[model samples]
Target: MDKQLSPVELRHQIRSGEFSDQTSGLCPGYTQANLVILPKADAYDFLLFAQRNPKPCPILEVTDLGSKNLHTFASDVDIASDFPKYRVFKNGELVAEPTDVNDIWRDDLVSFLIGCSFSFEASLITAGIEVRHITAGTNVPMYNTNIPTKAAGKFHGNYVVSMRPIPQNQVVKAVTITERLPQVHGTPIQIDHPETIGITDINHPDYGDAVEIKDGEVPVFWACGVTPQAAIMASKPEFVITHAPGHMLVTDVKDVDLSDIL
Candidate 1:
């Protein structure tokens, strides 16, 4: 698959079932979103939660109830089918993982497009930083932190973070590159000390596989899009849908466009 495809083209491939893989490197220069679809009844509070915790839940666009088309992010994009994978949760438990959720579409559903770390990851790679997980061909390591997000209604939970191991020398440069993309979880929330953030063992991540931390490298952590999912599970809404881990919704907006506008 060509990783250089435009976001619209990638979404088309996803919608048509031509592509159904992790969107990490696809649509290289475009913004990729973390999707969260919930019942209209729960939309207000969820929006509030995102607003209060922008770092971990930076929202890009919110679709109206029952409307899957995100006019602000992409034209003619079908939320139900554009993402490569979907995680169906019922009363807080993940029930099934599906490639398409057309069978479960509802008129009362509200979709939210949250900014993802992939956008900033692109910036880091372009700046010549080695993203450890990408080099090792593994998912980035994520952990549930002790840091509590500001509560909104019943939506509340500890923050979840993604970690990347960087050489001590490159830490400053990585921070410099990522700091410019505030919409995409800007900068490292914590660096070097995993235990301070409640992460006991560096090798045992709560989500994704752990990559080696070289002798001169330190673990750098960033607020993750997964934080909202952790919040959703804690809240235990009657029904909720989210993009599967690493399977994000590609958007028409470019990373440079997002950075420039900000």
Candidate 2:
């Protein structure tokens, strides 16, 4: 797929079964969202979970109960099918990795569109920082961390973070750029300390692919929206749907307007 496709165009491609790959480095300048869909019975708990854990779960849009439509982020969105990929979990175990969820749609489902670190990469690139995964043409490396999240109702788990190898000299610039976009996981949570966060093997991440930590580069970690999936795994929700790691929903909202909308 062309990296320059408009958000709606990309969604159309995804919806039509034409584009079913990770969304990183696509739709530059626009926002990409991490998805979480749960039954209405579990909506409030997840909502509370997100509120208690803002950094990893900054919410962009929450679809109305039972509705697949969105209001703030995109006009041509179908919560059931727009994302590049979807993971269905049953009792916390992954059951399927389908490109669309229309086959399993339920009226009682509630969708949460969480802010994604991918949304801020455009800024990082514009500032001359090399996003290693993008350069390597691979999914951003994400690791399960020892950093625990605040418990909210039945939703509770440790944080999941995405890693980027930032040049030592440009770490501050990368931080400064992302800090302005808190809705998209604002700043680095850990720098050059994977062991400090319970990650024994940075070379073998829990999600996505690991990239090289070059000579002058330090692995910078950012809170990731995949935190919910970790929570689902630990908390053992009966059923849940999520965008596969790195496979996100390209939203109509632009990264620049994120702060104002929130």
Candidate 3:
């Protein structure tokens, strides 16, 4: 787990099963992605869902039907194995959490690469703001909120958000920095008040680990890419695969270049 490894190197390590942990602070300066794989039958609906709800499920690159190779985001990409961890669902039930999905690969599966908050974390750190989870060596805390997403086909559910506690004085700076990268869920959706967004228990998250919120800091919430998983649970799609919460795909694209996506 050398933090200095290049994106390609880190991905290769993941592909080889040498790295099977969450991808948070790794591959700094480069972009990271959230993954969603579905049978061709469900692809169109999910696409529509993402299009309608861009903040949480920003589309970075979607692979061709039945193909796992990616060209827009990374060269030499193997979609099935590039991500650190994968969650497989069957009829909306989580059936497996595998390091690689090659064994269960299907010719009709489509891969959707969604923008991730980790992509913008480096910029936040550069702005002199601390990303608590990264510094604490844990995954960012995520919560299921009462915020409803714009329904699209069978994908309609509440928005899932990742929380990062920002210092009181620097909250606006964090917002200004992230607002520039809309592709990766830009800006804080809810600030300082978790209960307003249906998050009753800040200490216990539905996904990932919780971190301390210092006296001078406030909990900031950003739309998370994992919202689709909640949709799966709500709609019960027969088969779908996603990156395990906090686990992500490290892409070759740089964070500074993400504005071009807008």
Best by lDDT: 1
Task: State each model's CA lDDT, in order.
Answer: 0.89, 0.88, 0.89
- What TM-score would candidate 2 get against the native? 0.91
TM-score of each: 0.94, 0.91, 0.92
lDDT of 3 by residue, 138-167 (tens): 878999999999999888999999999999
Q: Which residue runs of candidate 2 sit more than 4 Å off their true CA positions?
A: 2-4
Q: What is the lDDT of candidate 1?
A: 0.89
The sequence of per-residue lDDT tens digits that candidate 1 reaches over residues 1-262 is 9877778888889999999998887767778888899999999999999999989998888998799787777897999999999999999899999999999999999999999888887788888888888889888899989999999998999899999988899999999898888899998899989899999988999999989998998999999988988898898899999999789988888888986644
Which sequence of candidate numbers ranks them by TM-score, best first?
A: 1, 3, 2
lDDT of each residue in 42-121, candidate 2, tens digit only: 99998998899899989888999889999898997898889878999999899999998998999999999888777688
RMSD of 3: 1.9
Worst 10 residues of 2 by lDDT: 225-234
lDDT at 221, model 2:
93
User: Least accurate stretch of 10 residues (summed lDDT) in model 1?
Assistant: 253-262
